[model samples]
Target: MVFFGDSMLETLGRVVVFLLVVLVVLLASLLSLFFVMLRTKRILFPNFVLFIVSLLYEILCRLLSFFRVDPTLIDRVSVEMRNALNYTEFAATDPRERILLLPQCIRSIDCPARLDSLEGICCVECRGCAIGELSARSREIGIRMYISPGGTFTERILTRSKPKAVVGVSCYPNLYEGLLKAKLMGVPAQGVPLSAAGCVKTTVDCEEVMNKCKIRS
Candidate 1:
């Protein structure tokens, strides 16, 4: 019994350490991105400072949960994400506007058995991530959400739909590209970047989008 207790404690300790390391890495990445933005003159220092502070708060909450000091913050993050989702606007009320959900990495057709399914095409309804939920929500909202695995497919969807506005899910680079394309084409666009959770799929709250659109109750 004592040995088992010790083993469990050790495992817990390791998990805490891992979480701390991840938090540090996330902070570093944010700082690096902010610096890059500064160099490129994309964002002002005030906005950068605000972003850094927000990120630090989120990281602190995550770290607290890692040590079992406060599990509530994990729920807070979920709530915040949901609220953020509400702040995004979709293109139309016609139920045909195209909203794209792009995954960074996808499973390849010729890869090994395990990797074969990793490609976005084989989105087996495993519900391993938030993609399923986001898809369901998109359907509920009468918006078309495509699971695009690459840039080519994403562009193809855009070319086909010609949506008035877009809510895209991608990394920084893809988000920037999509924003540029939208600007050039006079399409309003909102992007939600994926975090480090390895859950390539995303979580979007419909209420948030509705709120952004100022839709009536």
Candidate 2:
């Protein structure tokens, strides 16, 4: 009985060591991928490569969570990873194939945009908020624009519009989810994180979206 107990302890120690080794390896790979992305300011890889990189990033995040790290830190890392995905190609996508998705939180507090059954925000260009400005700019570029409240609404809009590519603007949490959704759908998607902070009455960098839209123009 004493021998058996000693052997079990040894086995458990070996397993722990192996797991630690793996954790270190994964962290190193994730950091390496991150540095490469930072240096290039873009992923510059095909979808296959991007998928692998994103998987590594997500794995690292999960592993870090085991350490009880702050959730916001993980979110920030996710946002940075999402941003480095080299949307250069997506820039040139056909306007018909692209959709610029904005968040409802970006609307003016008193704005009166109505929603339709098809998940469309009927913005009469009221100029009540930046959405109007963005909507008008997107129209000029001949790209479709809509306001999605969250992942579910964005999913519905994607299904209804069936856009080939998407550019979403939102806070880090929602933006991360939307980007993941886009990847799952095999749609080329990019996101812009809201510069301002908070859940409501937030603002986005409209110029960045316009620059992306102009990539195809």
Candidate 3:
């Protein structure tokens, strides 16, 4: 009985040590990649970095917070990584088969867009905000635009529109999750971060977004 108990304890200890070593390795790898990317404004081993980010996302963010670093830093890195990795495929996709998704918070406070079951928000081009002008340009280029009311509506719009590629504009955290979700759905995507992020009256870089929208092979 004693021998059996000792063997079990030893096995458990070994397993625990192995897991701790793996955790440290993953964290170290992510930190290295993060700093390198930040300094160069470029991604290195994007696929490997992306896998580590996805695996350690929550723990990495928590660790950053504990160390007084911005938690959103990881999200920003992940979004940029995805954008660089997906750029080729995304640019190759036809504009007619692409969708430009905007968050509703970027709209004017008194904007009068209404929600639809299939298309999230119906933009009337009331010239209430940049969406009107963007809408006109997107129409001219034969691309579809959807103003998502919230995060959940993104999947719905993608499913109904069946876009080959997507250019999504949102805050870093949302862009991170949105890009990951689109990747899982086998859709290439580019993310444009908001210049000013908030729940209400957020602002995006309209020129940057339009530039992304017009990327071609």
TM-score for each prediction? 0.44, 0.75, 0.95
Better of 1 and 3 by TM-score: 3
Per-model CA lDDT versus the true structure:
0.51, 0.73, 0.91
Clashes of each: 5, 0, 0
Task: Give candidate 2 misplaced runs (Cα > 4 Å).
Answer: 1-9, 28-89
Candidate number with greatest lDDT: 3
Off by over 4 Å in 1: 1-96, 104-124, 197-217
lDDT of 3 by residue, 135-156 (tens): 9999998989999988579998
Top candidate (TM-score): 3
How well does model 2 score by local distance difference test?
0.73
Off by over 4 Å in 3: 1-4
Using lDDT, rank the candidates from best to worst. 3, 2, 1
Winner by TM-score between candidate 3 and candidate 2: 3
Error of 2 at 89 (Å): 4.4
